[model samples]
Target: MELLPTTIVAGPSLLTRASALDQVVGKLRAGKVYRREDLAYVSNAVDRHLREMVSGGALKRLAQGLYYAPKKSVYGTLPPDDQELLATFLRDKDFLVFSLSSYNTLGLGTSQLYNKTLVYNHKRHGIFSFGNRQFDCRVKPRFPKTLTPEFLLVDMVNNLDELAEDRNLVLQMVVRKLPGFDQAKLKRAVSNYGSAATRKSFARWQDG
Candidate 1:
């Protein structure tokens, strides 16, 4: 009788997984946000690693499949940066995030402090909550990569109805301030990003 040699096939060891988990955690940076899918290439068992990390407080789940590596400040834990948070959430870098309060900086005679933060993107449309902050996502056909005074002026007029200030008063102020802006840039911004009502209002204002 001939004895057949047996070849042993061993599965991955517990140590191997632990090491991989460590590698996964090591790649995360404080104050950054991530989606589980973003780390899939980092480890074979990313979901399991993420679960364990979340349980161990090494990572915080911001939303479904979203994680944050929180940073600590003198005050307390710092939230993820808005750019990073949105970049991870939408899985796209082409988006604009701004607070309605930013309109006040345009010197348009608007003094209201708006708590709302609006995100304009092509991917997602609707509100989303991440930790304690909420972002209102609006899908727009066109938006600038960076905010500009011209864009803000057009956007404010577009969203005039949603503003808390007296719409008529604000519009009056916008009209009065129109002469101060570069006509070419203002017209281009209005043509590109303004709503139908906004376009008509701006056209009438420019004509006058």
Candidate 2:
């Protein structure tokens, strides 16, 4: 068989690129999410190096400046689910809280494991993917620092069914888990919800 040129034969420096790829993958495997700025801190060569590794199947791009290492499937295809990627991205962005808080606070519903994630943002709904599961962004109009935490707790309760299977279990768990939960605060937060279901849920939490 005819041989290609040495450059084409090597297809770029696999060994050197592999090392760079390993470093990136290591960070991700450690449960760390990275933005472009974070990668820039690692090396000036990150952009080109990352792109090369992505092309070489050493890395999977979640979105711009977000990535994950794919696990091998039975068929040998590397796949990472969307929720995993979004969680990584949210971890990096620092704008997300698990959806369980809502279920717990409102006595709404229950899930064996938490799947849905609530992300706080004012401008746009940030939705993106990593591998299989879908991620959704729900937008809020304004988030004041003082009220934001409470709002997060309240929003989760109001949308409890989005994350759980048994609403009563969720409520019981919240009441059991949260320390020093202010009944006044919970009542005030639920007041923001005019929905009868939310009010009823709040009553259940209070009675619990």
Candidate 3:
């Protein structure tokens, strides 16, 4: 029998690309979502590399500038959480905070998990979604200086039980963080609370 000549195909180039894709996938698997700018910062080839990975099924686009690895079948067809996605989108833009997120952080409100309810300085109109999560972006005119700082403190108080389950400790922490805060704005927020007793209690805390 006559021997046939075998052709050698290039493999190292493919391997190198696969290795880079693996690195990117590893980052995503570790819960790191890269923004386009971050990716650009990491490498000039990041965009092309990311596109290749996306085409090869190694990376899934959660949204523009957001991605994830689909190695585990857990996420189904849905994208990443909207808040997570929005946070990435607004990472460069200041004045974006989850409304309920701040409330949860402040140890003030009830324990209720909400979708991404972000408040930004722009006019309240931009709303979008990513995967199973919804981004309800609200624009606040006038860019009130008290909004972000005050709401963040209130959110800490709202999630006090989750923080330690010791109400006294939580209240103490809240009180401690209150000084140097905008007292008038804080009072207004307390007054806006639905319950008169709750408002009075918070007012006492504010005064104290």
Per-residue lDDT, model 2, residue 165, is 61
Q: Considering summed lDDT, which 10 consecutive residues are worst modelled in model 2?
A: 102-111
**lDDT, candidate 1, residue 197?**
91
Runs in model 3 lying further than 4 Å from the true structure: 5-7, 69-83, 92-125, 141-186, 190-208
Considering TM-score, which of the candidate structures 1 and 3 is the better prediction for this target? 1
How many backbone clashes does every candidate have?
0, 13, 20
Query: Which segments of candidate 2 are over 4 A away from where they belong?
Result: 1-29, 41-45, 55-58, 69-94, 100-116, 122-126, 141-182, 191-208
TM-score of 1: 0.87
Worst 10 residues of 3 by lDDT: 155-164
lDDT of 2 by residue, 1-208 (tens): 9997665454466776667667765565432334666666665488886787579765666677876555665687555543445445555343444544444443333435566555554434755444554456756544333434355556655666665366676567666754456656656666763256767755775676
Predicted model with the maximum lDDT? 1
lDDT (tens digit, per residue) of candidate 1 on 1-208: 9999999865679678778889988998888898888889897988788899989888999999899998999999888999989988998999999988999999978888977899999999998999889999999999998999999999998888888899889988998899999889999999999999989999899998
* Better by TM-score, candidate 2 or 1: 1
After the best TM-score superposition of candidate 3, give how far the Cα of residue 181 lies from its true spot, in angstroms.
19
TM-score, model 2 to reference:
0.45
lDDT of 3 by residue, 50-151 (tens): 898789776677676777655344755444543455556666344455555445545443355655565554643576655445566655443344445564
